[model samples]
Target: MKLVKVYVTLKESVLDAQGEAIKSAIQTMGYNQISDVHMGKYFELKFENDYANLEKDVDLICDDLLANPNVETYRYEILEGE
Candidate 1:
């Protein structure tokens, strides 16, 4: 089997409102050293090892559904799965 780890994050030009809120809460907790926070989404996908078009399909999935091309971006890593 194969494991695909996907990470989706807002583009640098986009505002991360949720991340800002979390950072504010964290700062209230006395973590003054915290400078910035960027929130993102993580996804884990498992597929049969024999999938011939795994990379291409993963890119398509990310482009079409997982990440928004207008304001978000995604990256993935393929790994061996138990």
Candidate 2:
């Protein structure tokens, strides 16, 4: 078995309105040190397959389902399971 971890976040050039709103709210409560915040998504996949082909499969998954390549960037890691 293998465990796959995926992270998806907005591209650096993209504006994160939701994050900005949260940051504003936090600052309103007196957390002034928060300069910026970016929101992201994480996924954990459990698969009973060979790790050799995992990267390609994960990339496909990210491109097709997990992320929007136009506005988001994604990265993934695979770990051997016990």
Candidate 3:
């Protein structure tokens, strides 16, 4: 079995209201060293031996369904042996 770790984040050109709010709140707490923040998502896709090429499968899933091409970008890593 393999575990696919997928990370999805909005494009840098897009505004991250939630992240900006968090950064602002944090700075108000007296930690002023913060530069920038971006909000993102993560998911784990588990696959058994039934898949011969899980990497390709995961890429297809990300491209076709899991991520929006215009506003979002994604990257994944596969962990095996569990």
Best by TM-score: 1
Clashing pairs in 2: none
Give the per-residue lDDT digits (tens) of candidate 1, residues 1-82. Answer: 9999999999999999999999999999999899999999999999999999999999999999999999999999999999
Give all candidates' CA lDDT scores. Answer: 0.97, 0.92, 0.90
lDDT of 2 by residue, 1-82 (tens): 8989999999999999999999999999999999999999999998886557777888999999999999999988888866
Candidate 1 residues lying further than 4 Å off, grouped into runs, are none
Worst 10 residues of 1 by lDDT: 60-69
Off by over 4 Å in 2: 49-52
lDDT score for residue 67 of model 2: 100
lDDT of 3: 0.90
Candidate 3 pairs with clashing backbones: none
In model 2, state the lDDT of residue 62. 95
Better of 2 and 3 by lDDT: 2
TM-score pick, better of 1 and 2: 1
